[model samples]
Target: MVGAGALIGLAVEFHALGWSSIPGNSCGGRYRPCPEGTTPTLILAFVFTFAGFTGLTVALAAFRRIRPGKALPGALAAAGVLIALWPGWQAHLWLRGPVLDPAWQASPDRPASVRGVGVWALGDGAGTVVRARTDALIAYDSATGDRGWVLRAPARESVCAMSERPVDGIGLVAFARDEEPCDTVWGVEVSSGRTVWERDFAGRTLLYGGGGVLSADGGVAVALGERSVHGYGLTDGAVRWTAKPTAARAEGGDDAECEPVTASSAGGTTRVVVTCGRYTDFHSAWLLTLDDATGKEPSRRELPVESWVNAAAVLSAEPFTLLVQEKDERGLAAVLAYAEPDDPERRPVTIPLTADEEDLALTGLHPVFTARPVFRAQVADGNLIVAAARPGSDDAERVAAYSLDDGRRRWHADLGTPVVALAPAGPGRVAVLGESQRLWTLTTGEGTRVGEEDGTTVRDIAFKIDDGPQLVRAGDGWVIVNADGDTYAPALAVRP
Candidate 1:
């Protein structure tokens, strides 16, 4: 049964990715055979067929083994017939087609659009928001469901990543390379959808940390790679400075393949932090920080635990940065708070996490569970907000705020379903999206459901404009793309 199920699973994946091609010249080449691409209907049909056949085969085999009589043979034959007819039933539903009502239009004040995954929108009032799609930068009007303006590149160049930065009264849309050996950058105006300036870099695959295209201080735009760091002028995309570390300096005695995890900028300079093993074994972890402006020799410090640091985030406005450390065999997890660069020698505040009955007993008071948690944590308003779900419970999700001053649970919100995205909207407020695809506004003490709509999956990271969260909806919903290159959503405003 396991083997049959595995085969069926592979078939479903192949069909969804559209790996199966049709045979030549059949039914005017219009009716393609086999998997039929990534359309949801075709994928659903294939999954149902596979599941039905697997169950039928298992049932028939089980009956034959148990009885081995004339009735057993007849039962197996009947099962085969039923399995064969299952696809026809599915086809009937498919051919009957989707029931779309023209009367189902979005409210005149709340229009929506379907942007790709991870697209971020910065709100500008009057239903207008600056949004980043997979290949273009667009201005979306949520009220009328219209795209006010769009800036798209030619076919030769692909947009790797985009960041919307508002400087003065103008919105700066920055476009960078999507692939390696990349060197082009373009900035467009949000109001008129016209190109402001374009610059070409001499490097490849520029990494944008923290503050979109410009640094937090608006002095330099920095990009980091495996072995080099480049800083461009924020006003114009001209090269301000470039730093290429030596192979030994970049690797720090560990394997040369391990790249540094870049840190977000603070004050006026951006920092790149790399962890390396002390010896060849990759056991000891060392933290190295480099300045974005000069990229000179880094200040290195050794951590206490000899384990890999999987993820780290910089906590702004606070005196220290929070680091998530995962250690082996010891079965331990630690959150280390390190002081700022000026006081590098100060000992970090280490909060050790362990798995024990006593530890679980400490629940809302002390740290519990040593296993590396799969949730994301950030500091909002002077409080540490962690979004985690209860173990082994699919529907149990909680967002807890821990006071930085005393390490106590200040407030906790039970989000009901699994939280898919969490972003800091402002001080004391967070924008959350659940697995149900519903949007919620969560604060320290309360969570309010803002809206729920079908056919929309929340992006992994959501952006907050002045008004609310910006979302993209597709699949089984109304998609309106006009000749002016506008995609509008009339279905989002529909109440259940």
Candidate 2:
């Protein structure tokens, strides 16, 4: 019985520590591990104590029967005590925090949040980039902090919006005159800062707009206007096409009342969501598909809009996911993931985001579905990849990926501190940057730890970002960007 209890305790402890013959076979239930929580500690302590007492009682019973003594039981108890007091991991470098001064730092008032709007980091290649109102676009050498190039906004006009990602090294930036709409757009070569093409249109967006303003790939650069979808040449900024979206099934007066809210483009596949209703009131929403290169509309599906849904935003385009929001609040209602391009026979999978405050919430970069493109979460390996963390803090506990089709979690790895930024490393791998300034890489296929570089930069440099942050790897060094904050201590730091 004593041995049996000990074996049971061992089994539970091993399982909790992620022991499994298979990668994810009934181990780590729910993937929410409170490694230092009091509950698990208390349970193991009680089991060991009970098992020790049972062994002592057996020894006494044997003593009265024959010749058994307390030697064996006493040695066992002392051994257990020693094991309980032992500290697990040694802290060598963490005890003395290492700090490295930045090679160059941006000013306190570099590109900042304007009129309560969010700031975004773009141009993910071998350079560091930031866009401000006056400095329409700026690129810096990652190691030297030298200004590579800057495109100033036109007089009396501010740079309003930019592309979510650069297409073949070209990025689009829009300028608005005074308080007028961001009508005039320009496609520029990001590396050289040369204007490739310029055009103007009736550029308007949702009333409550946010980041993820534009997305481009292949020959198409998509921008959602007030009621229409506009597609342009990604490299030349030439007008491709413009068309109004028709609902797959009309639920209101007609499709004319509908407004194109969110648009996402990846690998020649583009997705657009349109919401039809009166001012600020919900009626219905439509999920429309288009060829990213040609802007030809193929299929449109009317989403199963519930009363609790305030709006819908596409989290990823490759696998096609719609993030349903709680009505007039910051909570999430459900996540609807559509079928992949290759596998169209699979049914759409709908899963609800956790209402439980104790669990990690799926964090989106921006809440609104306007010209602004969402950059926080992405799709990889038929799953949506994003940072998930418990509420009430800026820190994220893990980076998790869930299958958009079946709603099954593919894998998750513990992020010891808040994840400030992350980007694709190479094929099948992602690089994650934590608030502690640590940088590491993990396999997107299995979520395995590929390698890690214990960061020497100070942890305080990271931001408690409400908006998204970004990590840019340039040459052999890295640039950590905290565009979410306005303060100047460590807004943008380059480490070589």
Candidate 3:
């Protein structure tokens, strides 16, 4: 019975340490861990005490039967040894020193309840991207930080949603916004910051979801949703075509919907990747490639169950179609690039994630304790810049950058907090956000802290963006020193 109790105690310790055979599987049960607010230290102490008491009681019983003198001393010594080591172990678990600098540790001036509004900054000091209110868009000059132009929504129409930052197009910044009765998509000239043209869907179901309006190199913009795809001219906002989503139904079963995950257009081809699942079971995924000129889907390929793409980017370097396959129950996720999306015979080049990144992704139960993988691929100069983190560790998580051209590791920066958001700064740089309400800028070429040394460069964030969370380049160089607190103010936007 003493041996059995020792085995049980060993099992409990192993489980708490996350030493299970299955990676990312904690012993606290998958999909559910120990309930919120359950103190691990208290529970561990209780188990160890109980185990020691039981062993001592057994030894006493044996001593009375066999008349052994040494049993009491041995059991007492064992208990003392365990109690002595408890403090050291607890210190190791709890004493991970602070990740923020004392200089940058000031409290946020903005209220905690404020919601982030849409903000985007342009390249080469192009301009400041701003949305003062939910129904209006404003652009400020990079030199002056003064409003360059403002486009207000009609009284009857409200801006329902926004796309990912300002997409650089042919002499224009293409953005999408869905209104009350219609969805409005526009291409505003960057130089003027005024809408060049606007397209609206009167009362039709607006295409909303991943990559709201993506600019194709061939002067086209595409929007994707679960049930439909819409394309428009980048210059005129003229409707090119609307087509049924390219998701197939499960044979002899109920209808399954295709939810658009991410999309891109490269080499005159627009690929919309969609995940097909019924209810909560995401069973399959595929990609639909359309010709830029006609908006006609030239090809459709159903991905293997093992290669369900979760995120995608059409990299400027080599025009590689980068796909992110998230870690699943079976295996760790991989980032792969293909010369062609439809060619099954063509092999793909895999981009590596930081070790234990899968576990970081699985930590979504608590935002502070978990990290969603950051897989943004952007073309700065001529290389594809990708950002990701290994956040399971508490002391500090590592945020890294890799060049897609040669699969070479460029740089990595150890961050004190789990990553909450990531955005491109400028050439060879990316901005990282943490739930601790802090932001840091790191170089892509070598993950060195780019701004002030000694962590003073890190800036305090007021709160996470509500509805539309976005990060953009700020200041003259690569350092993202500030967020647009004016736009994200509590009075300007309502908390959802």
Off by over 4 Å in 3: 1-117, 154-182, 190-193, 202-216, 245-260, 276-283, 306-334, 347-391, 394-396, 402-411, 415-426, 429-443, 446-471, 474-496
Put down candidate 1 lDDT per residue, 353-411, tens digits, no spaces: 32221111011111111101112455665466656545544343666665555555566
- TM-score, predicted candidate 2 vs. hidden true structure: 0.67
lDDT of each: 0.43, 0.58, 0.47
Q: If scored against the real structure, what TM-score would every candidate get?
A: 0.52, 0.67, 0.54
Candidate 2 lDDT over residue span 68-186, tens digit each: 56666455545544443322111212322333334566554454543212233445446555433334565656656666677776777766676765778777777776567667778
lDDT of 3 by residue, 192-266 (tens): 667788765432332222222344447776665335667778778788887665454657676666655556666
Candidate 2 or 3, higher TM-score? 2
Error of 2 at 331 (Å): 9.6
For candidate 3, report its TM-score: 0.54
Which is the winner by lDDT between candidate 2 and candidate 3? 2
Report each candidate's C-alpha RMSD, comma-separated, in the order given: 18.0, 13.7, 17.7
RMSD of 1: 18.0
Best by lDDT: 2
